[model samples]
Target: MSDEGEMTGGEDRPLDWANEPHMSSVDTIMWRGDTDRRMRGTICMLEIYDCSPDWDRLVAAHEWGSRMAPRFRQRVVDSPLGAGTPSWAVDPDFDLHYHLRRIKLGGDGSMRELLVTCEQLAMTALDAARPPWEGTLIEGLPDGKAAYFLKAHHALTDGLGAIIGLAQLHSPTREHNPGKPQPPSPDPVNIGPLDLIGRQIGDEIGRIPHRVDLALKGVRALTNPRKALSSALRYGRSVPRVAGLVSPPGSPLLAHRSLSWRFSAFEVPFTDLKAAATAVNASINDIYLAGLIGGFRIYHEKMGSPVDTIPVAIPISVRRPEDPAGGNRIAVGRLAGPVGIADPFERVLTIREQVRLARHEPAVDIFNTLGSVMAWLPGTMLMQFSGAASQNDLQASNVPGIPWDTYVAGAKVERMFPFGPLPGCAMMATMITHNGTACLGINSDGAAVTDLELFAECLIAGFGEVLALAADDGVEPGVLRRVE
Candidate 1:
């Protein structure tokens, strides 16, 4: 599951984006949940470039990218009754000036300053009235370096979906190519919540036959009552785990919640992470989670408040090959992080087994299965599920990155760090292996991770312990270095 997704499209064909007129139930939950700032589902990507892209060309690229993927120009319209998944209508008055921005770095021209600026940019809530996304081309870094921060609502796309969009948006060469396809802008729409109600009702009615078919299938299952009962019992038992209702107890050390966020960035050679994974005979994600828990272990010991285990959540991709590219098709997998294990290999092995079991849950697809119905719930009732993520100390995601070098305008992208939204978790970490480097973007809840400096050091050391497994191969475990 940690294997990266390859670039599978060419310029001749349009991107296989999610072009559905309405948001999926899960997307609806994220879009509406923004009412509670803590539940903001904004995902961001930060790219460090060799130099600032030609401003005129960069602007043209965004205009081109927006045209290639119409969702960028579309905004959500909630159902008039505030029930059911919302509709996506193209903005008749779409303005590129509003969403695209440029700024000069104010502090010392360092990665720390850049990421801190990004932290503030990320923490500020997106405007719900317009498209829930923004882009800033940050100039004035050292060595003529520049960074671009693009923030989007999780409802717009998941990690993988974002990758698909990025892959299309970026170029493989420094030189401009005239062969790139030029897509026409999308047609404007004049629709709102009132206009969506009738369509929503019809869509609900369209599912009546499927519900009846399911009922009929259940009736038929009665002929094999024993088997049906066993299956039902197994599914019933799996529901709690899949829903995260029966997960590891929350660690008191991470009990605090906050309105503010802190950011840290880290990276290492992809080979180092791969070597550790191979040494332990575990998936990359297994090693990734182990390293994170290992850091928590060191942090707890250093802080003098040790915890045995903590609630962790991972997004398991349920996206099938046939599914469209620009929407979430993920199931949440729960883990009881192995903080008590002192050995990194042991922690990795424990996580491998936990992930194995989590992946096989009978109700692993419960989110998507119930999303359609849940999206119709009233605001208060729908929000009750938001607390599930709050119980997690960490939420981690690993996305396979583009293996080849890519360029934006004429600026080469050195590395791309992905930051997932906190969503009440103490921390959210996302790693994307870009051009042989694994760039990690970490966001910590300000109240929970009070000592971010010590936290960063503990993280590097924690990963160092795992990378030590490659000692037999003569690899320097120090290859697991922090970027900022």
Candidate 2:
């Protein structure tokens, strides 16, 4: 099925174009295929649910979907006609017909089987494109269940922004609502050569002196015993408070990933995770990683290969509310997690402490700042090298969701699972809590983590164990322990 319609192009703006190394860094390391042209990140997945068999309602979803393409599509007007160092920004030119795809899974396959097929298909879509985004609605799974799969370039929107964009198309109430007020779609401002190049000049000039000073200070600190001692003390004292900024630990030896991908999901009630955290006085994020650790530990043990500590990466958003409107404002933090711990509670507590140390470490912020300087390298080289580097074992993130219930074409959104990239890593696990439900999306590499289903099961079971512990004692005592 397809919805064909004309899409009005948004106003054109001259984009600021320059070959900044860091800007290229995102392009090189993140992009997966032959051409850098596909820099827009893709968030693709298969959603399974039971829809009423009414023909009219099914038709309406396709019809309503047409009006939505222009809202979410992004266009880059200034991309180099030939493959080159940089591609400038522009508003996406969305085509409803081109973006939305529909196919009926044969009656022979179950919903689970259909989902597996979709995961393999998503992996095949490694190439990039302009105005980058695509969607497919797979209906007619076994037992009256259907699925919706969507992929949008990472450069276009982050997890939170994507949710907001999707919410625009949904009806506010259960009843069919018409003439719904459309959101204020911001106009694209073209950043041309003069604007982009001029700004780059100023930024570069300003950073020169600071860079020199830091370089000198770094050299002096290395040679000066007194200064080095003071810095070490500072690092130790600050580790606990900013531990949230670092990565969780994982084993260095991980399963080998193939070119193909596999997707899996499991449900853990928000109440269960919250209750478990309460039992241990940990935050939702802490509990979340604990579940991941439990899953990882089990995965390793089952394979007869386990490690005491493993390195994990956590993305820390540097985009403050008041920062300028465009470009990437995120940094990566590396932290170690103790997945080898046998006791679930002990592992949770250990992770909580490790995270605390990472959040408070001054080096976390310093490293991010340092990365900006390294961003001066060319995009192609960065991509070539980093792409070859070992992929992180898992990418785990929790994004905040809508406060109230939301509906899409009258289908009550019972759950929202966010599927992120599994690039170079074993898998990417993203969690979003909609209303009262915690929807977990796991995207695993086919070769490395073959048993994603089992991994997800462990996450579900680990949280259950933690909640049981919490039921016995209130969270206050655990909170008090950290305070003291």
Candidate 3:
């Protein structure tokens, strides 16, 4: 597939730093959740390949792209007394080199060594005072191929939003210019603590009329006794269901979590996964989750500690067509991982049904409603709530990515892997489909998942089990088989 039609001369566009973006309520929760070491930060990696571009040209391209998106040079500023959600402000001492790092691997520079470096990068926390993002250009691959690792705060943007922002710095073809550069932005105004507090209080006061209107609506609803009673009963019934969904039975082995993390990456043919899903009459996400459950089962069995189910958190994107590109616009969907199901096909069916029911449950709506109210909460209170909410055995996400060949600094993007935040979860497995391939990035807690190599092998075997359903003939699917 070619992205020629989607190509635009975005490089020439000037950035408007004056129009700064603020963190949404959902984003604020994620930001505050960083207080806990177990759920510290999130990072995403994009791997590019082929001819290596000149160092000067690569740095120039990044600088030009940064001018197009002011957020690249901005940092979060909290409101006084937690009166409002955090706002984005220009970083006075912003330096491109600080965020854009260039490193060269020694010798042959195998993928293992590169991944080791990436693990180190992932473990290190981003400097809070600066913009919450960094890009590392790693050179010296075996075949002169290069890879770029871009890491950013989860609070800045969700998976889809991050991909959209990255697309601005890439091209449909190698011989094209990146985003246009604009004049340097002016320094942001320095506001005193009292002044900031006063402004936030005033902003809160301005919403009095709207609050009163809502109160009146509540009173009117109460006047309709029958309607109010029915609504109350519905809410009352949903409480237990939501509570049950939140705290499901999980494996004891994966219960304990720590701050240490390990990263793993693998690629599978998108066509085979799609075919497997079609054959089983399930969505791609269903198959993916089934594979994860299978892997978890295998890992536990190998350790002589198997469990029936595992709690998994799935983030559902709620971004609308008219919504802006960045910030968090998502809700969580909890699933009871069917680890006990031995048959891959049956596992997929079970997952599809569970997910269908989860979507229909009122808990999802309640979760989204609470997400919108998180901005009004005090920082500490918000952190406590977020920390409790993020407790799950595992998290799986399927983010659709660029479906056509893309270029970054004249190099073809070989693969795109996304590593999401652990968020107190034992493991986080995220998949993104790029140019007909599904790339999976699995991040496991080092303290909880002790045997990394065995866990990785289990995951691979689990994926193979599902892929086997794609073949009509009675032939077992082996490791690394060609899908097409």
Among the numbered candidates, top TM-score falls to 1
Enumerate residue pairs that collide in model 1: none
Q: Candidates 2 and 3: which is better by lDDT? A: 3
lDDT of 2 by residue, 1-484 (tens): 1111111223232112111222332332243323332221457644444452234554554444433433233443322322222343434443456756677876466645665767656655533445556666677766565566777666544565555445544444555544432224334546565655555556678779998997898888889889888988887655432333233433544647666666666565677677777777788888888778776777778767887766666666665666432344555555565677878778888877876755555755643454444345545654454444434686677777665755544455555667777656777788878777677777777777766665655555555555556665653211100000
> Candidates sorted by lDDT, descending order?
1, 3, 2
Clashes of 2: 39
For 252-344, candidate 1 gives per-residue lDDT tens digits of 888899888888899888888888888778888887888889999999999999989999999999989898888788888888899989988
TM-score of each: 0.96, 0.73, 0.90
lDDT of 1 at 381: 65
User: Which 10 successive residues of model 1 have the least lDDT summed?
Assistant: 1-10
TM-score, structure 1 vs. true:
0.96
Task: Determine the backbone clash count of candidate 3.
Answer: 3
